[model samples]
Target: MAGRAGDRAPKARRIRLGNREVVTEGLELSFWADISHRCMTASWPAFIGGAALVFIVFNGFFALLYWFGDQPISNVPRGAYIDYLYFSIETLSTAGYGDMHPQSHYGHFIAAVELFTGIFSMSLMTGLIFARFSRPSARLLFADNPVISTHEGRQTLMIRLANERHNIIANATAQLWVFKSGVSKEGVPYRRFYDLPLIRSQSPALALSWTVFHVIDEASPLHGLDAAGLKAANVGLGLMVSGYDDVAAQTVHARKSYEHDQIRFGHRYVEILRVTEDGLRIDYSRFHETVEG
Candidate 1:
């Protein structure tokens, strides 16, 4: 007996947007498997819509249950689904109005169940909303493209970013990484990553703009790589900025990536800082503006 031909081939893995690698061959897990976390992390509109839908559906279901029994809710109009629905809402919210309420053991049991569901659901939704609002996120803005230009009489790789928030971000740090395809000494093709050394990667405070520069000298992996070479090798430059935001009172991070084509050679960023009669003025309209070096 021999194994199947398909089984002999190794599975190919795919790198996703967030650098997450997934094997092509595997048991695909259902999103419902981790529904709690998914709900907590879901977008604002999605989470709110889901909660609204659940609330309506739950009331509708209980209304139908009340309609099935004889006079489950006292003072509700005879055979009126709408009236039963209203009663269900009141019971679920524990807002027992004097006008109508549970009239029998069956009614009491159903109301009890709805009350419990309402409490638990409200608590879960409150926690998720608070988590989303409290999460720390950086508002750093990166330049549209990276540039290569002359700096201090040497060719340098430059990237610019600004802290959009007026508040201070303490102990800010940045890192630049380059990913490119290359052939190993053994003639095997592989993807390689290199950390470019920056002139100044750390900042005590970041309230305005910061320009990061990496000297492309002999020590750099990109020393010999020209624009054409970079394109041929499928280069990608990744920039990461992290800092402790005073206003947020927590660590926040932001990242951006530029492809080979997005790197402009012999180019420099335009000036964005200027002094006005009132005070310092930053023209954000020209933040991404550039000029040929």
Candidate 2:
């Protein structure tokens, strides 16, 4: 059997964002061309390990250069690569320990180049650390699954999210979108996107839980879609939330995605908020709980 048209395309990479892994094809970029981006996105352990490896490789290269030179340093030990490596470390770090001093012009030149490289690398590392620390991130928690049930005499779709940081988010806004695979009039296969209008998509101050709702009426894009229908069409849903974080003093955004099977129909979220004698209390333990409507 012949393979699909997309299978014949040159595959480039798979990138994961939110809950989707997008398959990109027909193009690729050189690693050096995007080194900065790669570094910024790398995990802390991986970044530190890579930096350490580079440091060792550079010091080893300089140590080899010193070993080939004739009596470049005044160290007592002769023909010792370990001693030369120690000297390279001291020079690269600019420690200038008087015990081992460069006595030849070749040694001085190598020391000078290593010193400059060390200074430049330290400055670059400092900048990268500062950038990573200053990057704004959202601590928003989303429910594992969305629910569909009757609300105010209409069938509705609902998604729940909370501010896990417990900080005020001013002028918070939300958007919901759906993707579905279909064939156009000309019989061309395509994936189409549609926006689902929500009843209340904005919150003046979101510090706790918020549930956005969308009535699945005749005008809605998901008006008549059932579980089987959604599965057959390969439907996917995405939710995006953004707001100005009062504590961080910057705009932060969060997003999540749901596959067709993750939607729970004929169900509603369990109550988590109650009025106590002191004030109001929320039971986060029940936040993700849902029951049949």
Candidate 3:
């Protein structure tokens, strides 16, 4: 008897699962299943969706049985359609409510399959929920706003961005670009772009928001530039930065020129900033180390 029960175990388990893939088919039933499968591997969703479509169509086969099975179609059985729909729902939920029992052997077989289908559906939904929540959504931390100040005779632009986990860059290089109005051969309105190299380098620290500066130098097209000139030019500054901690990703951003009046010349301005727990803090006073040519 024990051996017989043990032999029944696999079939019982199989009944509870149907085809593991079958439960994940159909838009209504497959919604959660698709989520879980995509969380597992890329190929699973296409397979799951296709499989669900097949399963739903197969359910329609059962519907056809109700509509035109061997059962008498001229005079419909009282409450029989309701009974089938209710049974389908109960079986699909593994509710085993027992309020409605399948009358025929065919009906019993269908109920058993649906009961198992529900079991697998529940398991896959659980897996997908956990997988989605468990995976980290990497974040990008930028400063509250751009800072504007004057350096020498020209206006400047600055912003602070920190690698909170110190993963974005270990020794990344950044190139500054600007698009502004410049006369061209077309004689029509023109916006020209140019690259500006930082006089200094990115710091060795990782978790800190280094104060990046863009001074409109005399050599620059931005040199002797003012807000109206920039407005006429329709200017924006782009930074192309690469090199980051191998563990995390890095991004590039474009910040625009500060208004000429917004900047204070020959004065260094300080802004409050925070750092990640794992890494370092910044000291712009060090950037002051540049010796005059």
TM-score of each: 0.87, 0.91, 0.43
* Model 1 pairs in collision: none
RMSD of each: 4.0, 3.9, 18.2
TM-score of 3: 0.43
TM-score pick, better of 1 and 3: 1
Compared with the true structure, what per-residue lDDT tens digits does model 1 show for residues 47-144?
88988898999999999999998888889876699999998888877787869888899888888899998888878878878887888999999999
Cα error, residue 1 of model 3, in Å, equals 87
How do the residues 131-224 of candidate 2 rate in per-residue lDDT, one tens digit apiece? 8888898999899999999999999999999999899999999999988999999999999989999999999999999999999999987889
How far off is residue 280 in model 3, in Å? 8.8
Off by over 4 Å in 2: 1-12
| lDDT pick, better of 1 and 2 | 2
Clashing pairs in 3: 25-52, 26-52, 150-264, 168-244, 169-244, 181-233
For residues 135-246, write the lDDT of model 3, one tens digit per residue: 4433334444444455555566555555545454556555667666667677777766787656554655445556667766677766765556666666665554445454
Instruction: Indicate the residue-level lDDT of 267 in model 3.
Output: 47
Which ten-residue region of model 2 has the weakest summed lDDT?
2-11
Alpha-carbon deviation at 34 in model 2, angstroms: 0.4
For lDDT, the strongest prediction is: 2
